[model samples]
Target: MENIFNFNDESSINNVEIHGEYSLIIVILSIIIAVVASYTALSLNKRASENSFFHKNFWLFLASLCLGFGIWSMHFVGMSAFSLPVSMSYNNIMTVLSIIPAMLASFIAFYLANLPRRNLWTYFFAGIAMGTGISSMHYLGMYGMEMDVVYTYNPILFLASICIAIVVSVIAVYIFSTVQKYETNYKVQLIISLIIGLAISSMHYTGMAAMNFYIPKGYEMNLSHFHSTEMYGLAIIVTLGMTILLGILLLSSFIDRFIEYRANYYDPFTQLPNRRLFEKKLHSPKVLAVWHIHDLEHINREFNYAFGDEVIRRLVYIFKTLTPSKVEIYRIEGHRIALIARDGDSAKQLKGSLKEIATVLRKPIIVKGHEVYLYGVCAVSDANQYENTPNIYTNVLAVLNYPSITYNHDIVYYDSSIHTYTFEREIADDVNRAMNDDELFLVYQPKVCLNPNETVGLEALLRWNHPKYGFLSPAVFVPILEEYDRMVKVTDWIIGRVCQQIADWKLENISFKQVAINIPGEYVTSPLLLKLLTQKLNEYGLESSQIELEITENSFVKNMEEAMRAVGEFRKEGFSVALDDFGTGVSSLSYLKQMPISTLKIDKSFIDDVPISPKDSAIVQAIVTLGESLNLNVVIEGVETKEQVNFLKGASRKPIFQGYYFAKPMQPHELIQWYRETRVED
Candidate 1:
């Protein structure tokens, strides 16, 4: 019985050695092919994960071919190492046919490994397919052998070889799945490749060892005698072809990865390197300038996104045309173009370049037959500003809200003394935490009514005793909050706190004629602030007349009409509005008339020099007389010295004052106690 399964007598099989007679170079070459192909496949794996559906499929298919060819190459090379005693030839058709199963098995294994999502069942099925396919390929190649003998096999040993293949397949798939795309552990991969090579080799030789070949005495061969020369030529041709295929795949993967790298770090619309690449190269001695498009949002809102995109593209051209070769331009964020000088230069040169950029941007561009005018602010890096920061983009963005930059629309260089990026972030974080954690509280500075010799009112001031940075002044933290646009939120919190305190004082039988809270200039006209104020007053069951909103002079100076309207709204709603920092701002008399102000608080600068500088005395008298003529109560703040107080009294018929001279700002309880103690004297 030829091709029979001989279960009973194992002695019927020919003695087969696992190694047989093999060329060391051929065996080593096959292992090398496996290692190289496997490594290339791993390289493509990460890209396959990140790519689009179509591109991912393309890479995955190539990976399958890459790994499959290596497996096919290893099998062929290992087969060539097997030396038979009798003259042997292979059926040409079957020898070629064996590669089909080998490649199919490889594809199944790779497809399972590269599946976007995977689990236990997919792995199990993939292992079964790969193991069965490898076993079938080995036997198919064996079946191609033409010799004057009948072949038989030990079923148990043959089954064991298949089992070994299946187990190895599962292990290989597990390793592939566990490996990360971006990170390649070369040592682990090398070890894995070696292990897989040995496992596949073991299965091939084990199956071979289980097979038996016998002459059967009557068997006759009609085929041509096998030649060593043709076998060598066949081996060389197959090895060369597989080698070339793997090489091409490896080269293609390298190029694809390079292109992917470039795409990730660049803005596709502008074809400019993005913020990520800029930050990677951020360092001292390199000048950076950020240009912000002032009206991009308006353009986007008026026109379509496509029109906005076109506008940005045109702006990119201007940047490219005007920028020198030495300076690298990057489209960092939305409507923001950043310039970095590759050649180390002073901030002065960058500042000039930024000014030129701003001037060029002032011109108009035609987009789709509609002339579009551009306006923007350019902020330049300072030469002497030395602060190590992770995100230079954010550091530059900090300039966007600077008073210097906000008003002038010119290049505001980074000032290390005034602009501290890290400190700002720390303070913001602490403030937010304090807001949430009830760590913030308030203190009050008493306002004296001179004629009555009593504390008439108290200005509610925000206070924070930070665990790390103790007793932070409003001057230090408030400006930073405003720059970050968090002042509105802080103000809302402050309003609630102040209203609750006022309610608490009522319960304690402590009273004041009025209480004032300083409001940011930006919030003077805010509807939200008005709504919040109305709600808080109602919540505390207090009248609006009891609380005053103190606004800075700059608010009225910047937007007179809006400021006046806001002041009128406050007064109409039964709340008093006062103009703070009176003498320091431009057009002092203009603010008094333009604003519907009930009180004018003379700023400390003019009051500080009173009685000492004669010029300061004239300025104080003028402000006092102006307030009296307008029928507005005048408050002189920061009145520290007895001499300044004397001068203020002589200059004005009556004076209401606030500052350290009368009493420093105190906690709510301390204010109540001081009032109780001072009421007796009045």
Candidate 2:
């Protein structure tokens, strides 16, 4: 039959001085392989077009094209180097080499930019499959010597074959995942996973298809003749290596793009995830960690906003030192840095670790030779499915507001129960109402003179009347207010009301004497708060001596330099400052000396259990003795019983006050009514 294949007629027509029928076929297949490889190069170049390195894309594309064509040429040139007769079996082997185009086509399809740079194993796997195909065909061609084929499979060697395939395939995919870069999109991870899966499938199928070559007469296949005859082995190595290397370099360029984009999204101030970065990476099924700088606003007002900004930076540095590599850090707005643990990595231990870090951070950063210290409220979320980063974030925020955990310098992790959250929400609602309705009332816990039955002044205790929940105690709402932005608003309302109430009584010919109001650390820095108090005093025709702003020792010296300066600001404005809860917090001799405070209100805790609880009694005595020596007015609180009052009078702590014993806090009308009623009862 006449040959219909046009390439068969190429020998008779004489092109490029063809040496053998097999040579003609090899050249034809080589040309096709070269063309397909060129297309692969173009395909890769197309993917690189949007890359920052894509300008270098053209160079890579040209290089790939030249190299791919050279691989095909070299394969044939190496084949030509073999000393082989123009046997029919040899012609068949050359025909089988045509499949190289198919392999190249698949390679083009698989080399992707959106995959992980870690999966270069895909390319290595490809090399393994190609090598297997080449080696199998070479052995099959050797059988064309017309000898009986003998099959020998060693168990160890057979197992090694499987091992090599898997190892190479896995490593290839890993390389691809590692080098393949995508935009900051998370799909890149999934894409790399898919590509590795494809590589495994490719290796398996190619290995399955490896078969023996059928030999024809007039061909002697020997190792020496084989080396002399065919450069196919070397061609296989060089060509596949070049192809895999190109894939790596190409994929790696995109990975570099992803990394560069990620770096751009980092927050400059904190070196954590910026707002843009957080929104992008925050995902479903994630845990959120919230870290709050507890005294940032106070820091800003006293030392200037720059100090606050530095505190934020310093906090970030502490977090960077404390967290694990698998944890992702995000700067959530101002004064909060959040950590999102990568793959739930070490998340269970996050709270404890964060607490320790917070304690370490509290040890004062030596900023400009000043020991600048900071504190944090850290909360982790419940490890539940509903916890997308947003929900997890909410959970963590809720914990930061958890009064017991936050106030005590402890970190709290999430619990499934909603009771604490509900409690906090209710308190916030009441606080807001108290701010608006003037329903927020103070209880005058009386501080009585030890020997005399006369009341000198009342230490104002905060109380709230919820339209729904009845009278809410200061213990529940005060700390909540203190931690958030609303504390300043609430404090202003309390101060304004107290001053006005005292004024009305004086007008009524009742000597209300001095009234003490608790001032949150936030209020101390507020110049507007002072102005508000001044306005109220002037309107009510009250003197500066009529009002006292009581602050705890903790609040008085939280940011020492800031607190000292702010106290001076308060004193300068004619409002007297009291060291409320003095012995209870940081009782260093320096605080009493440095603070521009007028009165020392011994903490209610020390006064409540005094004399009976010897510890409490000593604290009371020490605080009283300190105040007496310093010429500071000593006011004792929490006098629930007459026996406690007797103890304070016996201890020589003169002019003391108490909480429960005086009168549980009353409204403005009740306070005036109680004063009028006190004299009537007397």
Candidate 3:
């Protein structure tokens, strides 16, 4: 043991002392290389966990290569900085082989860092594995030196170097694990990189301190060639090569991040900022307005979806061209676009802009060589009035859905006066509950024949007895249900209940004419309604003539062809159809000529002040005359006084009257009792 191992004692006289000097510039450069490499590896590791299996493995491999080559380059650069009082060079094969340990160590470190479940024990084992690899690489590279000298190490300092390396590895692993929690925190990354760089440098220098080199007795030192240019050139080449590789990796990562950001924050179809980005940009004192394309679904159904998409693109383009630069637009949802204004006069300016856009939208837009007419309405709200952006967004969406505001092509500013919006929102949220809890029911109003002075038929009116808000009128909740696309289900429920009631009435020996049901505009146009009515009638073992369908004039306004076809189908099946709420819509006179109807019921608005109001009397006279001219059965509604009845009786033709004048809407039992009493009197 004494012959093989020679402990280098400082007091020995035969040993030659050789001190090495360092180039300050090369030392600093080595430290920078270590830091850059660490940052790149850490950044890569951060993204690895978020990637797919293939991408995650690819990133890990690249990170390992970067850190491995970086450490190798830094080691050589640091070695090139140290100059001894002798000529020294390294074996090429050994120098290359030393990098294997570094890469292996890097892979281990990153793999452990990316483990799904980690603990103190995981980090400690990772540190131990990494520290062993680093120590082996350092000693192996040190031994690769070819020189006419003997090498020795101080036992205590040698162990101390290994300890320092292990400690640094533990710390690097811990910091790498912690720093990943913060996203893109460049300041913290820099600080961590610096600390890692300093720690690596400390371990390398400590290993160097442990090393001692002495010239053999017979060897002669060539001091003149101590500074080798070739060696310095090698270090520079390695550093540059590693830097270029890292730079390429960084560029690739940046491109990936950019694509990810675009996908997350922008809508692919409109190429506009999406709801996520819009919500992020919401701040105080900003005016928010949402423009909803009311007839977009109709357009999509009539044409193809592609044509509808083109329409939206064109609308967005028009909005961008017409609105000022201060107003930022976002594609919030299907058929809905949102705008935010940040200027001082944003509310007034935004309202004006909305009106301009609405006017422009009224004109038919040419898409795919087809002239497509679209109806849009804007709901504007002040952000300052709300507590947060979410509140503003919620209320604005509710306001946009207001039945009066929809399809009007007008801009409505939200205020306390728009209480209908709030009430409608409540109704929409609770309507399903209303159905499940049997809160919805029907009341029948008797339509009397004026000439015979007897009850002719009954009109079924829907009523909601809400647990929270009692006795809600159909006028308030029906439109809400329609706006929310829930009318079809409610209408189905209504039809089923009416059919069962008619069956029950027959069992009780109650004799009456057919009962009239007011079908919503949506139900009238929907193909499902006819099928449902047929199914219900057959299920109840009743003929179609026992039930009557009352459709409003506006029902024809949506899709006249479909509404007319559906009504025609109903009439063909032996069911009578009444054009309810007559003479209320703008094109009622024009549509009356085409509508296939058995009855025309005048709206109550024209009958509320009939005797005194000359205009009301004249309108009523014209409607009655029009019904008689067409030979259609006319029903006058909202007659609460006998004077209105006398006036109607004086008309050229007698018509059915339904109002509070004779009998209000009643329950099933009351209607049965009233029918028997009326029949007895007749």
Best by lDDT: 3
Candidate 3: Cα lDDT at 442:
87
- Higher-TM-score candidate among 1 and 3? 1
How do the residues 584-674 of candidate 2 rate in per-residue lDDT, one tens digit apiece?
A: 6865777578788888877666765676899888877776887888888887766655457557765654565655445656666677676
Worst 10 residues of 3 by lDDT: 1-10
Per-model lDDT: 0.71, 0.56, 0.76
In candidate 3 the C-alpha lDDT for residue 532 amounts to: 89
- Residues 251-346, model 1: lDDT tens digits: 775676456546657887888998656654565436678887775878888898999999988888878877777777888777778887644553
Better of 1 and 3 by lDDT: 3
On lDDT, who's better, 1 or 2?
1
Off by over 4 Å in 2: 1-426, 450-453, 680-682
Better of 1 and 2 by TM-score: 1
lDDT of 3 by residue, 1-682 (tens): 1322243576245666566678888788888888887788766765575422236767777777777777777777888788775777789999999989988888888788767667888888777766776677788888887877677788999998888878888887877766563323567677766766665677788889988878654456666655543555755656585666678576757776566557767999888999767765765647888888875878889898888888888998999988877778898777778988887676667767887888888899899899988887787778777665445654575576555555757777777467445756778888788878889888899988745456778888888898754555454577668888888788788889989998988887764668898888877877788888889989988889988999888889888898889999999999999988888886647778888999899998898788889999998999899989998999999876546866776664667888765776898878878777555433
Error of 2 at 522 (Å): 2.5
Model 1 TM-score relative to the real fold: 0.48
Kindly report which residue stretches of model 3 are placed more than 4 angstroms away from their true locations once superposed.
Answer: 1-20, 28-66, 84-101, 113-125, 135-199, 202-265, 283-286, 298-308, 345-356, 366-371, 381-399, 405-408, 412-682
Q: Which candidate is the best by TM-score?
A: 1
